[model samples]
Target: MISKDPRKGGLAGRVTKLSNSEQQNNPLHGVRLDAILEELVAKLGWEELGKKINIRCFNYDPSIKSSLAFLRKTPWAREKVEQLYLRTTKKGRK
Candidate 1:
């Protein structure tokens, strides 16, 4: 069946992808990984973040440049950082 929404002119159920505006609801949306790292380090500190995420980049000689390089190549680590960013920001607001 065709989608009633003109933005999605094709079949409705065929794909359930979110558009850019819809994705703004995501906490990480439009947030750069480097920015996320800086915030985490500022809020949690590298030692604490390493304890939480258990990654060498955060544990030893941690720097945003190095951490970002690692996170970019490693999906699992990047996901961890994004999750922590969301959690940290939520707590900050409350």
Candidate 2:
């Protein structure tokens, strides 16, 4: 029997991970989730990052561990974070 839990693979019972070739051009390909969270926290602080993302993990009693757990299971939220990271870093390069 397959689990209906999203954390347990969701209704599909599995998730597809992108292959190396597929992520080759991605700036966040090799970036670890923890590192992303850490950098965002460092650069934006929980208050600003929370305001930007509007996520509970960043808004209330935020911590790297809690945020990581939430973001790992939540793809959309993770994507938002990665996009924010890219945008924030891009500005620094100029």
Model 2 scores worst on lDDT over the 10 consecutive residues at: 1-10
| Candidate 1: residue pairs that collide | none
TM-score (all chains, Cα) for each model: 0.73, 0.74
| TM-score: model 1 vs. ground truth | 0.73
Give the number of the best model, judged by TM-score: 2
Task: List residue ranges in candidate 1 displaced over 4 A.
Answer: 1-18, 91-94
Candidate that scores best on lDDT = 2
| Per-residue lDDT over 1-94 for candidate 1, one digit per residue giving the tens place of the 0 to 100 score | 1245566775454545678777765666668888889988999899999999999998889888899999989988898888888888973253
Error of 2 at 62 (Å): 0.7
Model 2 regions lying over 4 Å from their true place: 1-21, 91-94
